[model samples]
Target: MKIISAGLPRSGSTLVMQMLKILYSDFPLQKVHGYIEPKEGQIRICTYRHPFAAAVSNARIYNDLSDEHLKNSAIYIRKMAKAVDLYTEDGVTLMLRYEDFYLNRKLIVSSLVERYGTKFSDMLVEKALEYSSIERNLERQRVYSDFAHWDSETHIHGGHISEYKGDPTSWRNYVSSSQIQILVSILNPVRLRWGY
Candidate 1:
């Protein structure tokens, strides 16, 4: 089976990938570039909301497909779906909101199993509990880092979602209001749904 473990960098995707790897113990996974290049038969990362990547695509698509553009007043959820489809066409996709897993992990694992079937295993679930047990996820707050170089604003942090109490806002101290808005606009929906 093919597994892609990336989805826009700051979306708590790496933690999910690690948890999956630790849990399944059989995941031959690969991290693909976000829109840099496409490689077949490998799990790819395509964060739907990262500003830099999104900006690049918006520019490219607008430049190329601008002729067929839809009106600005439209909600355009289909466009989002098409983007997801373009990047996430085959195999199993594991794009867990860091906040969701942080707030409630058991539900997340079970839901993933229900949606994706047996791709998620008991051992992986067990290990997630082991790695993220409340205290461990707290340590991750300090494990995160970031940079603002205009082309991209990347924040890298580590922790198991099972450990989080769903308060991803704690990371707010590390970024700016602008950053928070950007992340919230993209993640708040899933985060709230996931209970983080």
Candidate 2:
């Protein structure tokens, strides 16, 4: 079966892809950001983040906090919401939250392995965890330093972890109250649906 890792731009999709690549070494998996038409027998692993956090991350990464960017981000979030909703309804896709990746990675890996009906050694699982750890990816970011130098295999680009504080709510630190209100107004429905 083919495996596809998908999600929004600032979601944990890349991290999911990296871990899947290592844990499912014998299988072929691809990272396709956002939605794609799934094929039969394909395992679609879709990741999602809180919309407010996503908007803050996008703003910081692109250095754009204008109204235009906010509007665009809302549009992107809506599209991702639709994709995730479809994935959820399909019942075959594995829907993962961003917080679970950081807080319960091993469990996520185990669930994926169980769903795929594959057995991997403990050492292999550990290797996948270590290789996809945030620290290692940060080191990769320092080395890459630019989009042109990003690691194609792992998809670790520079500034990938902009201002990570091990807190999902850390987005509040970078954005103003007004911006937060705007984001909340725009994304509250999605937040409610996703339990954010």
Candidate 3:
């Protein structure tokens, strides 16, 4: 099956891509920031994060907390939201949440395999499950320093996850009430659709 993985900038797209690569070693998987037109036999897997968290991460990464930044992030979140809704109707496409993928890798992988008729090894799934922990990724970063820089360092902005308290909602601590209002104003519709 042809697979395309995409998400908003700070979403866990790379991690999902790496995990899928491990699960299906031979399949050619493409990762993109924007939507791709999936061909007849292709399946597009899209990932998304809570808009509040996404907006905060965007600000931190771009180092710009202006209204412009929030507006842009809100727009991207809206676009991905629409994409997920349309893509899922095709039966071949699957929408995965970053939080769910992080907290339940095995179940998500199994569900995707069953729903999409994708082939994967149980043994590889087990190994991937074991390696899904943040500790494992952190260790990988230590051993392969370049892995930290392989994608956007926004995730490990401080060169370490531990520094950010490592919680998805940690963005709450950084984003102000007013700034959150800005995000919510633009994202409320999409956020509600995603059950956020």
Q: What lDDT score is found at residue 29 in candidate 1?
A: 59
TM-score against truth, every candidate: 0.46, 0.90, 0.77
lDDT of 3 by residue, 1-196 (tens): 6768776656676567667667766667787767677687675777777877776666655556677887787777666666666665656667778777666677668767877877677788877666555666666455434323533421233333434634677877766788888888888887787798
The local distance difference test score of each candidate is: 0.43, 0.78, 0.67
Provide the lDDT at 121 for model 3: 72
Candidate 2 stretches greater than 4 Å from native: 146-149
Which pairs in model 3 have colliding backbones? none
State the displacement of the C-alpha of residue 164, model 2, in Å, after optimal TM-score superposition.
Answer: 2.1
The C-alpha stretches of model 3 lying farther than 4 A from their native spots are 66-68, 130-132, 139-166
Q: Which predicted model would earn the best TM-score? A: 2
Winner by lDDT = 2
Which should have the higher TM-score, number 2 or number 3?
Answer: 2
RMSD of 2: 1.9
Tens digit of per-residue lDDT, candidate 2, span 97-165: 887776778877777777777777899989988988888888888986554468888998777787563
Candidate 3 global TM-score:
0.77
Task: Go through the candidates in order and give the clash count of each.
Answer: 4, 0, 0
